[model samples]
Target: MTKTDRPDGEDSGHTGPELFEHANEEYDAGNYHRALELFDQAVKKGISNEVMYNNRGAALDAIGRGHEAVDSYLKSVSIAGRYELAWHNMANSLFSQEMYADAVGAYAKAAALNKERVENLSGLARAYLKVGKTGRAVAVIRKLDRFTDKDAAVLLMQCDLYIDAEELVLAEQCARKYLEKNPDDVEGFAHLGNVEHEMGVYGKAVDSYEKALQLTPDDKELWNNLGYTCFLAGFFDKAIGCFDKAILLDPLYKHAWYNKGYAYHGADMLERAVECYDHAVAIDHNDPVLWNNLGNALYNLGRYRDSIPKYVEALIVDPDYDIAWNNIGNALEKMDEYAEAIPYHDRSLEISPDFDYALFAKGVCKAETGDLEEGYNLVLESLDLNPSYDEAWGARAVLAERMGRLDEALLAVEESLAVNSEFDEGWTKRGEILLTMGNMEAAEASFQMALTCLESSHADTAGGLASVVRRGEVLIRLGRFEDALVNIETVVLAGRTNSRMILKDLELRRFMAKYELPKALVEIIRKIAEPGIIAECAEFMVDAGNVLEAERLLSVVRGIPTQSSKLTKAQARIMLAKGETDSALMLLNTSDGRSSDADLLVINAGAHEAGGDFSKAADLYSSALGMDPSNYAAAMGLARLMIRSKKADECISAADIAIGIDSREWEPHKLKAEAYELLNAPGMARFELAQAHSLLAGTGLRPEDIIGG
Candidate 1:
């Protein structure tokens, strides 16, 4: 008869009965993978009536499916509660899973079923040791010592207890004792590795992992440990190889993927890092921090558009994410879409009100979008948030200077240098303003300070290009145009040249200030060079008496192209020159009194006086105060008109305001002469007019050319 069709008597010696024996043979041959499959088949047919689940569980444990093996052992014991062997197998699985409490219970049950089993007593002791029940574990180990010869486990547990109890010397001694008897034991090797790794002895940890791997070549946990130890010891490539092997052996290992990603990042292979993070996310997508890390990797790789959307996606899952909002703002700013960026920064501030970076970003974007006052206020808030944020303060100094608050700009720049003494941009800007104030020696000092600041900063090609170009302009302002050309040509050789608006500003007293063609071509070239440089160049032109160039430059800047405050101000400049004051003011169309186009306002007052409207001319000067509260031009214009109308007190007040704006301007001092003359203050009038004559010497006016000359 066939073995399958044999009766119970025949089956006693049948092939089906031999199935378990064959499974055991496969297991003994070190084919635990194949043995597990055979064991399952034998149990399905109820062939042996032995504790098949316990043997199957042991095979599964060998294959690294420790939790499943534990379930199999429990099932075997359920079918036969007195199965002492099944209980022992269950305890082994629990111990592997680190479920010390449950493992101790299983060991206790096994010992109850077979009171003489020393292995059961040993298992219970190990479980208790893992649970920090060290005294209970030692008591059980002492009972096992009476019968068993396996001192390896007992000595290992004793070492662990010593380490846990802060008895480091004793732990080392016990580890030595265990290793003396079992030099080849993998667990003993792992325990010793842990001790060294925790003590920062990375070299020793690596040696232990290597020795353990040699004894158990297929041990993936050991491989992963060796990789981690090597990584901590700064051997990244070697660690990567170890993690690669661990990942191959266990395809679902999440930690191996994460560690590999970190190693790749350290090597500056950012793209590979992002690729590894993608794998980790696929394995487990719910990790918010992983998503943030992935976004940072993408950003560092210059995939800004890709990175920003991920940050937004992370924010969707976690709305109060300040860092995500900060990154989103950065990407938006890089895109030069500041109008869109400001809201994200505002939201970040809402969540973390003292978030200094968000405050700075919000202000800078506001300034970029043309709300200078609002932007300046936001910058002040940033300073309040972090008083030592030198970059923000330096940027604020630039804003203050642009807004015509020169004294405040100087103070802000000083504060900035106090925070970061080597802020090159701050020193450069402060020097330019000092030069404009005719504080030539102070300006030279500031320019020298810039040299020091630049020396301490990172001077890459871009920074060097910027530095040389700016130094060229500074030299030009100091009437050192020959020296300026050297710096300008350095920029030219780098394929970055033609800065017209900047040249117009630096060429104030030069004969070419009135020239139009050179300025127009330069503006066009800068507009074409980079879109982000366009607004600054345009703003510079608007303030340089070349508003026409500003209008021309904006037409090429794209998106809000062909239109801006600069364009309107340029047209207004023309109308003011033509004695068309009302039309010029109407062209501005400012919604609030916040227009700081001071040159435009000065032009308005000129047009008003030319059109025979002195009263309206005085009001136009008042409007100029909003553009520049300290504008000497606005103050002098109103004072001169008031003197012509023979309004003595009114002329005096207007002159006071003008001198307060800039005591150095001749017109305000001369108007004060007229006021003093009409008031019969002859000595004061002559002294005031003398000061005016001195300031206006080379500015194209003879002494008698003044109204009261």
Candidate 2:
């Protein structure tokens, strides 16, 4: 054996060559510390040659002293610049220390020195990948393709680099190439699975991951990958099983727990998903994504209060988390704290300016706070970003209606219902706008549709109350007093918080038409104690032939401090209906009578007609019509008297005017039918009676009433 090959420390005066040989032997035996000592001793003895330096570098690298090894290899390369082994070894040490740029330069030099060295080419590719020069890595790998035996390890690394670059097609190619030679390579199949997943070919990814698990049944990482692949494929149950296996293999596998939580979430098992997320958070509490997902599950459960804290925790971990900011706003809005919710929406908008959800939410809050114009503009901007947002159209409908733009409101609500046909609120809003337009028949149909569309669970909602009030008012206008009372009483007894005029008007109309209201209806009115209610009830009792009860109710009304023109009109109507023509005439002869007050003129005309003064009644009706050309009540009154006076042609024209003004009233149709029968047009009379029959549905007034008139 050569003298330099002798065991280290065997001779006190050992030569540098003997010491270098002994260091090489120790390095081969895996005794890195002893080998480092021997190498240092040889280097200090002035025996530093290229081979000795390179050998010392290798021993230093084996001992995990990568930086010192890099220096030693640099010395070897400095002595002999063409030494490819030294350059390659230096590049590897730099790579181990994560000095990727330096490693790239060193590997390039080695590749130039020995083009036939596969290790040099492979190392150059690895260094290029580490430095993110994926194109250069790919080019260097192509050079190794000419070698007879495929470098499976290099190809696998190439797959990982391609994946990092998001070049799934190339990644899949590299992984398949590696697996072609090493068919049992578990990592190769796992890489292929990852490539397929990135390509969104989840079914293929699941197959690839399953193949990987077959080869490495005990690999926890493999099980996790398989589980994630299954999750992507929507096989949540299988994903949970794979994740469970991974957790079984390593109880502290936080990623497995996190992934299992997602699987449970996808399967709609929110409680189990929460349990898995809790376990994952316990293992790694600092992951913001985990907190965000936990909040999402809670939000899905309608636990807005519970979900708020979880979202706040996520924001604490990641202040710029736009989704968490949006979620916080959503939870607060759900709790009706719109003022507090707006700032979080603003934060989310600051992070993502084009966020449609944030824009819609902020707009709704503004509308709730009475900034209808500004709120409408914001909602328009949101719709500009996302034109398919159905709820934005509904918001626009409400804003437009509040602004008195009924045409615009109608169009917006129609568009909303077109997008979501089952939207009950949209239907109710459409009905309300129609009611305002004096389209009582259409309004009734729309309200009926809204009531039918309502979910049983939401029967007591604010929207439900609004729908009831709207439908009841429309029924009152159409003279369906019993139907109107049914709905109005239900709403009043359901806790009448809002003094909606429609509800009060509906109740007053019902009390004026019905001779006697049920105790429940009377109690509802007494509880509300609106002056309009008391006046209408007294008028109704007087008309029903109960003068004492009417006088008692009017005494109670006179005792109250609140006075209104509606009360005076009610008293005059009651007096006229009770045959007290002088009293009714006295009340109607107000200072406003000569000024063409249509209401006072109509009341005076009514008193004259009840007193059998047809000429005075006709002149008074003409005066009322002169003041308000479109007064349906005055035209209808004139039409009825004209029929009594045998003036069928004028009756027909006046009836037509009244019908044009308000077609839904069965009274106009009955008047027209009577005029048509007088003119001997029995077919037209039947048609008008049919219309009256349809409009006065459930009013106990049928086709016979119109025909008899």
Candidate 2 lDDT at 548 equals 71
lDDT tens string, model 1, 487-506?
A: 55445434433333233333
Candidate lDDT values, in order: 0.69, 0.75
Record all residue pairs in model 2 with backbone atoms less than 3 Å apart, i.e. clashing.
4-18
**Over 4 Å off in model 2, which ranges?**
1-150, 380-709
lDDT of 2 by residue, 602-697 (tens): 887887887899999999898898889888779989998999998889998888888888866666777777888989998777666545534443
TM-score of each: 0.42, 0.47
Largest TM-score belongs to which candidate? 2
